[model samples]
Target: MTDSLKKINKQIRFLSVYAMVSSVLLLIALFLILKKDRITGNLTVEELTANRINIVEPNGLPRLVLSNVEKSPANLNHGKPFGIPGGNRGGLIFYDDEATECGGLVFSGRKDSSGKYFASGHFSFDQYNQNQVLYLQYLDDNGDRKTGLYVDDWHNSPPYPEFRRTYKETEKLPNGPERDAKLKQLLEPVNGDPAFAHRVFIGKDANKASLINLSDKKGKPRIQLIVDSTGEAKINFLDSAGKVVYSLPNKANH
Candidate 1:
């Protein structure tokens, strides 16, 4: 080839290589800019405030909720318009991946019409569409107090939907004998023969006695071991009627 042709060809080859390199570099820079915009490394904030905050999963399912009194969200157990007077109580609520309320910590205190003070703090875990299966609670009513831990059993049939429906219906009824009777009938399955009942209670009772109570599935306390305020210890076995069947160390002895 002639020197001039060779030189021309060499120049074209160099320019071609340079163009390819420039295109790759530009593409890489564009990719980095897009990545930077899409990512967040860390953030710091001075203060954040809101009535309620929900932490959710990528699919928008709520996993946790931190809320003030007025904004507390109701759970599956309570459904909507929580029948209780303290639905506005402040608390941190937790939900399962399915967004079912599993448990939470709650607290409230108020005075009744009779000027009697009442307060309670509870941290509980539900039995999947059922009432609280386990809980730690502190309750004070007009200076009478009881702090305890409880584990309860629920009937398997009828399920949560029926329970929630009955609860809402009962709430609409007027406060009278009729309502009371309806409540009793509706609750008969749960309260009367409860498939399983209060299984365990470990706490201090209103009389300032420290006790551990174990009950039968029929809701009858079968055994109670107690230490009274004066430090007297007694263990009692009771029948279904709650009448003491027998006592250890005899009631007369400390």
Candidate 2:
């Protein structure tokens, strides 16, 4: 071939290779951008499996966590841990905007040796920085079961960790009047009233009675609407001491 023709052919070949490289680079850049968009936007997958998954906000504050028993997280208050480490059971824990533990649903059911079995499920929500104020729980141990919806009261003066610390301190003391008095004082922080109480319970008890119990501030049952296992129904109203003062069908009627 002539020199001029050979030089023109060489130039064309170089340009062709450069164009191919540039096109490949452009395709790669587009793929990267699209991948980032999928990450920040919505990603669909057929299956997901993980020991723990934390859904967080832009600020890295966790809003929810789904975890197995071994990977569950400790309770949090204002982004800090308190009380005990979690990992007690598998469940989902929810948090507030401040990263405080707001609520959770945990469940466990297992059969041990000797044919003994136990199962429990608890769903609860706290009262802001305080302890659980409402819950639905089911407990079954060797055929003895209690399922209930509970409404509780918590102290507003101290945070839950502080209250727990005080209780633990009191528990370490020798069992006697002094320890009892300290425990009592810890629970009754404001005036002589009880700080925490189970205000309401509506469910079946271990005794095979379906009942709705409404208690006083001190957690003493004041009114009970019961349907016993025998299908007998009764409404009882008690005084502060919890002694039944009145009944729907009086003893004479019975």
Candidate 3:
């Protein structure tokens, strides 16, 4: 072959190789940038769904997989991957010392069908017992769905960790961000109703009071009853030591 012809062929070959390598490198760089954006929530759900690829982060941690992945806090069940799906791993579920950590709250209050979410057991108390903390939780995230009275308050001290927690008040209460308005609406008695005409009263044996059927509001009947030939009235109370204090009979319950 002629020298001029050979030189021309060599130049063409080198250019072809360079173009192929550059194309592959550019594609790789684009893929990496797109993946990084997804992990930081920059990619919308719609974008991710169409992408079909899992959004993996540093350490190759898969934070989410389009619409096919879910994750939970570690110690979720004391298992690996913490409690998340998608293979995303956080070192561990952090355990805070100064804050109290207990399970979710649950209660069988009368307002709701199943129950309210109050503090889990492992109660807390102030030195004076005056500022007691009944483990309370947010069942609805708003604290308006449940009540402590209906769900027998289980007062038992547990370890207090260092995060924020809610508590229920049995007798002594705290001045937190004021009782939730909805809570008051649910708890207040229906006033001016002929059905609940009876008023609450206190006496030495106020339990023995004679009833005239919601006559005056001193202490009235708790619930309406037809009283069959064989039925008994029951009462429940607590004592000084934070135990069932006393239980009296419903004398006027006839």
Among all candidates shown, the one with the greatest lDDT: 2
Per-model TM-score versus the true fold:
0.72, 0.88, 0.29
Give the alpha-carbon lDDT of every model.
0.82, 0.92, 0.32
Q: Which stretches of candidate 2 lie over 4 Å from their true place?
A: 1-28, 31-35
Tens-place lDDT digits, model 2, residues 1-254: 69999999999999999999999999999999999997686877999989999999989999999999999999888999987787787999989989999999999999988889999999999998888999999999989999999999887878887888889888999999999999989988778778899999999999999999999888999999999999999999999988998998788766
Cα deviation at 118, candidate 2, in Å, is 1.2
Question: Which candidate model has the greater lDDT, 2 or 3?
Answer: 2
RMSD of each: 7.3, 2.6, 17.2
The alpha-carbon lDDT assigned to residue 150 of candidate 1 equals 96
**Candidate 2, lDDT over the whole model:** 0.92
Q: Candidate 1: misplaced stretches above 4 Å?
A: 1-40, 77-87, 110-116, 168-185, 190-192, 251-254
lDDT of 3 by residue, 37-109 (tens): 7655453454322313333446554443332112323222212232223323211122212121123221222
